[model samples]
Target chain A: MLTALARDLAAPLAANGSFLIKPGVGLMVWTLLVFGLTMVLLSKLAFPRISAALERRQKAIEESIDTAERTRAEAEQILAEYRQRLQEARAQADEIIQRARQTAEVQEREAKERGQEIVAEASQRAQREIEAATKRALEELRNEVADLTITATEKVTRKALDPEDQKRLVEEALREMDFSGLSSGASNN
Target chain B: MNATETGGLPPRPAPEEARIPAPHPTDDPAPKSSVKRKLLIALGVYLAGLIALIAIYGFKGHRNELFKPQNEFKLESWVDLGIFSINKAVLYLFIAAALTCVTMIYIARRMQQRPNKVQAAVEALFRLMHDNITASAMDERMAAKWFPFIGTLFLFILFSNLVGYIPLPTNTENEINVFGLQIPSFSLYAATANLSVPLVLALTVFVSYTVEGIRAKGPIGYLKGLIPGGVQGGMAVPIFFLEVLSNLMRILSLTIRLFANILAGHLIILFMAGALAVILGSAWLGWFTLPFGIILFAFEVGLVAALQAFIFATLTAIYLGGAVAKDH
Candidate 1:
């Protein structure tokens, strides 16, 4: 059978391969069948997945890069906001400190002014007291002098002196002494 | 010698044994066991596989068939072609196809978003198929659509071509007698070397692209688009027919180009080995042809394997592009 096959093959390679010039219909047909089967199988089984895998990976990479970009931008914005807030906070604290200092100075000034006024009022009251004491002393002196005078007069012409006149004279003398002018003059001095 | 009986006359089996002297022991090729002999023989066989061998008959038994002036290429048949007998080429094709299918299926199932080293390499090759062929020739949209076909075609041809280089058992006369019947065993041949394989592949391309054109432009529109845009009046009709003729010619050209290139490469490789064998007729002389044959053999086996496939795929892509062009 092998020699027979060889013998057949030898005929084609002979001087002019009558059959060889023409391509084999059987092999061509077989090739078509085989090629078609393989192509269809490959296209169905192999190619789709290969192309799909490529495209899928490409898309995934693009998406990842996009996500990274988005996150980076957000981070930058947040940083900017954080920095701005920090600056604002710093400025506000400084303002608070400044306001506190001003308030303390204003309170000190008010207390100083109030203390000076109170000292002025106390000095005036002391002067008024001194003037009142002088007046009391003068009244007592007048009473004593009047009494002495009355006693002496009584020993001489004391019976002639009126009690009402003495009282009135003393009251008149007290009324004549104007403590306002005197005290003001005393406050000035 | 029956040299007077020409090929123009219908071939008659004249016993060639009479004119051709019986080959002596020295006329036969050196043993394959020698590294030098192996390289030279491999180179010669590689060349022999290619081209339309005019008169290179195969070895006489185990003789130096190379550089024998009147020899014809040995068209060994595990089965026969002229008589429609299935050959070893068919068996090899099936084996090659099966291996390709199994490998592809395994790699494909394990395909990953984050690929392993093997997957990455496979992806690179796959992407190269698209980039080199489809994307280079057509628009992104078209490339996407056509990638499956083009990529499959390239890889299938490439695998088929590469597998052909695998050394099969030399088809020297073998005898194993079983019950008074002598059984003959022969070696396998590459499917790519067969003209029929390329023609069928070319036909596939031809049909697909034509269909694409028709699908792109409706049947009538496609016929109309064959004409040049500028031509008007009666000239357009002739020019349109001419264009159609040119388009049809692509089928033949694609088929022959692949077939011839592979055929030629094989013939040259085989011729070299054949030459070395002949040189071996003189002792120590055959060693001189060693490096040249080995280099060529290695180059074709390594380089031409991928290149021929690439050319076929790229051309197909180009044809596909032209078919679907908006202007045409």
Candidate 2:
């Protein structure tokens, strides 16, 4: 069977000549025409669309990258600005707290001073009133002593006396008494 | 009877000759033993078949029956119309062209940002041709201008080379009768295997680069630029002539490279498949040769087809780039 097939294959070799190198005019013309038509059709139809799609994808990717970079930068800028503002606010808060503390201290000192001044003025007025009362009591006590001395003299004589004699007697009695010592004792009381 | 009496077909083997020896029926206690017995029987049958083949058709006078290399590449027209006739090669070209257009257009129409399998494959192919072949050789502007031509060339040739590997019913000279209908036998043939196809393509590239060179530099300047730099006086003339000859040789180089590679690959496959057995006059030799044939077929399909296409396109780009280049 194989021998027969081989013989069949071998039969045409002598008559075929050199078909391998021989140029077929029809084949060449067809190749050129077909290749030319294919090239034109592809150039006009398929290649451009594919190239455009690829370019479009490339452009979109670049744009996305650019946008991402810009967004990141803007976010960083905003974050920095926010941090700066936060630091400023903290400084302002510290300053306000410091001022409040200082103001509180000064107010407390002023209040203490005003309380001391009020206490001192009250003690001074009380002392002045006491001194005036002591002086008036001493004067009243002296006048009462003169009247008592006159009554005692009249009782012992068992008769009435003139105004000049009574006054002289009373003066003599008052002079005999230690009035400096009495005034000093009254001031101590 | 011979193939001539059987209308270029071999007579079918008798039932006894075709049948594989059946294994003896076994009543084994274990299934494992049964499986092992079957495997051993299969191996024995294979070895027996090989031995039988060697004994029947030993080394003898069968060299004259071997298929010739030229017969495989013969171009007998299916339809002859004076100057324009359709042959197998022509049919392959039409198929390749149509496939190139349809696939390109279909993928172009359905392109996506995120692609499915087929779309991704097409896109990858596009990028390979555009970036690796066209853009890499030339600058962006030139690549853009010539991408369609170079891309189409690459795709057309690539399809042509690939489809060549697939066996098709185009061997009209050898027909087989099936259900009372005569059908052409299945055979591998490529359009690029023929000299005319690649020659035409190479000629196109040659014309393109030359025109581009002339367009970039005026006619006189383009001719003068062929001389290498630092060349002067009497040396310039010969150098310029050699350079022109070399430039002309690019067409032949391109043509022979594609045509020879594809033709040689197919011939090797044909030889390895059955021609070797026919020459050696041993039918058992086919069993050994078939594996090598399969391996060669794989190599041709996997690497040679795409590689040839890539080289052709890349060379075209280089020529175009060199032609328009300021240094050249």
Candidate 3:
């Protein structure tokens, strides 16, 4: 059955465009057209895009690396700035503290000197007052005693007051004045 | 503070403490993908071109004034070029060779800086020719030395075979004038489609191998190589003689094989295509046969072209390999 079918096909095949496959010229024409055209077309169209794409990719990669490097550098710069600012703040704070401490020390020394001067003025005033008071008291006492002494002197007239006893009373009055000056100075202090 | 600890603490703020940038990942396989994508595109374009050519032929009904069948011959005077007559065949060879050379030189020139698509494709073809044809069978270093001759041989034969199908001014079925000869100008024949072309190529290969063998091994050594070891007395001489004879036979077989393959492929395609016209008076037969004929023609032509080139290169490599073999 296959043989019969093939045989029938053969007649039609023979009648068909068989010149296209003829050995000498027909076959050669076909070969040339296929191979030559294929080569020509291949060379003309395909390779450039491939090469360009590859090169572009390589360039992009290189650029990316450069960008990363720049980023890293910027980060480092930021870190350095942070450190510098921290140091500056620390130094400023230290300076302020030192200045405050110096002011306090000077004020303390001035206050101590003012207190001593006030103490000395008070003592001098007290001493002067004490001397004045003592003089007054002695004068009053002398007046009263003088009256009594006159009466007694008249009654007891026979004997005049002795020189030794007068001398001794004058000495006692001088001692009492010194003791009063000391007590007044101590009370002012 | 401990003096050592204090020293270490100060160094903790060292200027060199900046962070190292991480290495960029180069694991992206874009290039490989791009290569594949490009190949796919090329394939698409090549197929489109084939379709375009087919459409053009189809629209025109595959008929041309020149293709109208007729045969006539007029004897023409021949110009002698010392050794051989510069006949029509020789003229065609020169023309085709000139075309191939111009194309090659143009590609090479354009490739000097960077290869554009056309140049790159051409270069890839050459690279394939070198690697698949030459280096695959022999030392790459040696292949480089012999590249010019081997590459030219493969390319010339391949193109010669391909140019056969081009319906040139000279290649009509009827009589035409070429170089002052009234002859069948366009006969749709690949040089390799003819037996003579492959025979000549084979002879060239044979001569190259023989000369190379002699050069590498010396004349005496070349002859001695034909013999196997351990042959005693008189037997050695005959064995050597037979070996030489067989080697010569190989050249003949190689030549015949290439010629037969190409010739047969062409004949089969021709016969199949011609069947329609012969059997039917109407042109419908031609159309009917065309699809199958074209399909077969494509497959056969591709096979023959590559096969011929491969066989030729393979044999040449074998010969060279033998010549340079240390054992021999």
Candidate 4:
């Protein structure tokens, strides 16, 4: 029975076995050759270039980063100094502006006080001149009015009286004039 | 406006803050925290299940039946031969294929967006195999060339080795009809149960390493490497013979190491699991030996799986590294 089973199994296995081994063995060897050749080509040609490129790239990146870092630090230092200077300048400008504003205010107050003093002096001088002119005009007007009254009275008396009458009128006039001069002198004293 | 007002305050840790300086590593990988709990939990669950099964089998006194070997269901006819060799262990090949396809495809897809835990685990394994194991030994560019072959070998062997510990239905009591007779069958066995499996794997390694060596150093250069440097006429002949012998020995050693480790691990698990029932005769005995056996089983399985994969990858890497040596 075991022999029968073995016999039955053998027939199909035999026919396919040779076919399987032919392809299997050949393909395996071919694949092995291809793989070996590939490894050779890669190790010789491919890998070195890639490895070199990688090393170059890494070095470049490191150098770039170093340069960037140095630049950044320098910029930061410059920024710090600039900020310090800017702050000091701002403070100084504020002080200068404050001083200028204070000086301007003092100058403005002095100008205003000088203007007010000039205005006061001009007003006082005008008042004094007006007072002296008014006094002189009043005295001149009083003397002129008295002379007109005397001339008019002499003309009216000449028309109405003769020569003898006129002489008497003149005598009366002279006596009155002398009394008036005495009164005038006493007032002036 | 202030940090505390928005509830962003640094947490007022309890008095035990001194004991635990940082968060768990699983929670936050920034600091070293004990993964003791999570690892223990995973181990504990595995142990509990394994122990429970062992206790149940032990109480029933089924050791002799469990360990008993009976031949069965082996194909004695031509129907078995095709692209794939049919056997119970070959199911592990399907498991490997399914695991690889599903895992790799799923990982490939998910890695495009977000990697899941299983994918991450697999990717990490692949990365360690490539970067630390392979690339560290050879140039990274050279390592990439050999990554696929070495990576696949590691994954297949690892998964196949691990599946052996799944406690599949592999008892000899199962009967099958063969040649008009009902015979007992060992239903489930480890893929590495047969030496042929690891032998084929080692053969693959042999072919790859030999081919790589021949390629890097030309055929003549490769042959010349067998000769000792600075040897005189009389000494050269003897040294050349020794070198040939050693090269032959390496093939045997690499094959045997992987085959033996996997085979021994499976045998030990079989015996331990089979005899677990007899060892737990008493309640106290069951409590003590059950944990011990289960713990040993779990650790052994995990260790063997990882270690075998590691060794296989390492050996392959070393072989390839030697082959591609420009300065040698």
Candidate 5:
């Protein structure tokens, strides 16, 4: 089959009025003219614009990337600063709370001390007042006891005694009587 | 040579053959069985399709109008004006050139920072030519200088090759009847497939590179630089001549590579699509060859078209770069 096909192809190739390899001057000229014009037109009109556009796009992309990188860096810096400030603020807040707590604790201790001092002073004053009152009540009781002794003597004698003798007798009676226990009781009360 | 010569004993198998093991019992059988069944079904379907085609078209295996050389590659002039005659090749060239210009200019005009799909495609093409082909082969200064020329060459050849694969109504030799009206038959032809087109383009590259070399190095220095630096004395003479020959051969190599590849692809497509069946005079044979034709067509369109253009432009850039380099 191949041999027959070759034979068929070779027959015309050999008999050729026009061969495959044969070149036409007109066609060559047209090709040159067309290609030349195409190259010139493209180089002048189309290629420069395309190249320019490509360069523009490249520049734009590079600029965009640079801008994005710069923006990212700035954002990171700002974030760092904000984080530092926040840390500082937190530290200050902690310091303020600590100082306030210390102040409250000092005030609380002073108040407690003052309350105890006031309570002690009041207790001392109350003890002094109690002593004074007890002394006054004892003096009044002694006077009443003396008056009652004189009345009992008058009723028994049925006559007035001399002042000196009465005084001496009262003195003797007060000395002989066991008034130490009565004085002790009055002091206890 | 027979077994009788071996004293009536069976011949021993070669060592490699003896080492061949039988199928292992542990191997899975389900997938293999399924694959075999699928193959059998495909074969049966292909045979049935071929029989149907034969029944419809009838086997006429004595026809002789299969391959026609003139109809395949010949250019019939539509207009004649001495050396400026317009033909099918000229029309294709004009279309390719115009398309290259319009597309580039249009895309260039509408270019945006964020490209649409079509714009992105165009930009990708531009980058491929600019970076991969041009910049990769030459320095920045040289690439800038010659980018337009090399870029145009790449785009032109690429478009020409791609446009060639499309079927158009350019086959004036054949006609089809459509509702009492006659129209030209559809055929595939690339302007780059013609010898003249690539030859002209190659000549341009050759001249441009030679000029650039001479410009960078003085004419004498350029010619002397063709020889390798290690050679001297009597050896240099032959080596210089050989180097000159090799340099001159670049033009032919560049030209023939593009032309032959495109031409051969088209010819194979033509043969496989219908010519083989037409030659065999069997209607069912066309059904058999059609799938192969489709596959080859897909390959040619998918790979060869762009690859050829890329190689051509890349070689051009390398030549230009080599011409100007201090080492050269």
Candidate 6:
């Protein structure tokens, strides 16, 4: 069956094209024409631009990377600066608090000393008032005692005595009445 | 009598004779498909290669010309271009260029600081080409001068190789006959499958390197430099001949490698479909042959297309490297 079919096979060149293992000049011309056109179009318009675009992409990527690095560095630097300022502010706040505490303590001490001085002045005034009252009371007691002495003298005598004599008597009576103790006590007070 | 009888029906390989594995019988059992994606990819390529081999064998001498009908496995011209000719390969070239042109133009217009999906993919390809081919070979300044040529070569060949995977009209009977003359049509186009395409690419590289070498070292200096100075005696003449010969071989090797790799892959895919048909004895293999062939084909051919383009570009850069180096 294989040989029969093979025998029936038509000559390759019969109304059909050849098995083009050998190169054709027409194909070569076409090849040159198409290839040349492709070359002109590509080199002139496509290849250079495309390759340049690729190179441009690469460059753009590199630029972005560099920018990223720079931005990161700047951000880190800013962060460091903020941290430093925060640390300084915290230290200053601590110092201010300490100074305020010390000032308050000094003020409290001054207030306490002034309060004691006021109390001492008030006590001194009360003492002076008491001394004046005592003096007044002693004066009144002496006056009353003298008047009673005079009355007793007049009652003992039937007729009224002369003023001078009575005064002398009263004076004698006060001198004889042991008033030295009273006088000594009043002087000690 | 099946394609598996390799003794009777080996694939008629291209003149370059790519190494293709024969199709395995079901009795042998199939290799497990569950593995790493990369390994699966490698394995799929291997299997797809076997299928392509079978297909090549089935369509032994399947090449055809547009107007002429006497040869096998050769593509004949449909329209003569004074200096060139057109066929499926030429059609593929036009398609490839238009595809690249439209895609690049779109991508170029739509390019942004933030790229969309298509833009991102194209950009990555550009960077890959520049770094791998241009930067790897020499310093940046010299690389810049040659990058466009190397880069364009890479993209063009890549698109052209990829276009082959499209299912367009190919083979002998698919031609449109007008007044007994046929015009070839192929949406399924693989430009690098044609030898002439790679030849032109290599020749361009060859000329570029030659020009660069002369520019770097004066013309006299370049010629003198080709003959190594360290060797003083009778060895000098032979060494110079050998060096010149190897330098010339760069063009031949560059041309052949690009042409053969993609052609082999394209043929492999063709053969795989044939092998499937032969094995199942039908155009339809109960949802097995075609869908599986397509899945396998996509992965395998896609990888080959990219790989060949890269290799060609890389070699060109290396040539440029040798040409523009400050010292010998």
Which number leads on DockQ? 5
lDDT, candidate 1, at B301: 77
Q: TM-score of predicted model 4?
A: 0.53
Ranked candidates, highest TM-score first: 5, 2, 6, 1, 4, 3
Q: Per-candidate DockQ versus the true complex?
A: 0.19, 0.38, 0.01, 0.03, 0.41, 0.29
Of candidates 3 and 1, the better by TM-score: 1
The lDDT values for all models are 0.71, 0.86, 0.59, 0.59, 0.86, 0.72
TM-score of each: 0.60, 0.69, 0.47, 0.53, 0.81, 0.65
In candidate 3, the second chain superimposes onto the true chain B with a TM-score of 0.65
Question: Weakest 10 consecutive residues, lDDT, candidate 6 chain A?
Answer: A8-17
Stretch of 10 with least lDDT, candidate 2 chain B = B59-68
Which regions of candidate 2 fall more than 4 Å away from where they truly are?
A1-17, A85-189, B1-52, B55-61, B64-66
Candidate 5: CAPRI quality band: acceptable
- Report the lDDT tens digits of candidate 1 across residue range A30-149: 777777777778778877777788899999999999999999999999999999999999999999999999999999999999999999999989878877777676567767766765
Error of 3 at B244 (Å): 2.2
Model 2: per-residue Cα lDDT at residue B182? 100
Query: Quick one: ranking by DockQ, best first?
Result: 5, 2, 6, 1, 4, 3
TM-score of 1: 0.60
What candidate 6 gets wrong by more than 4 Å, as runs, is: A1-21, A108-189, B1-76, B80-83, B170-172, B175-187, B224-234, B275-292
User: Pick by TM-score: which candidate is best?
Assistant: 5
Candidate 3 per-residue lDDT, tens place, B68-176, comes to 2211111122565443444334444555555666677555545544457886676677767666777876687777566566666666666665665554544333567
Docking outcome class, model 4: incorrect
Model 5, span B1-328: residue lDDT tens? 4688778788766689668897786576877888899999988998899999889888666666545744667888789888788988998999889999999998888888899999888888889989988998888988999999999999999989998999988887787888988887889899998999999999999999999999999999899989888889999999999999998899999999999999989988987898767766777988888878999999999999999999999999999999988777
lDDT of 4 by residue, A1-189 (tens): 548734543454454433212223322332233334433443454334434444555687899999999999999999999999999999999999999999999999998999899989887776666555555654554454444444666576654555565556555655455444534443343
Tens digits of lDDT, candidate 6, A31-115: 6777788888778877787788889888999999999999999999999999999999999999999999999999999989898
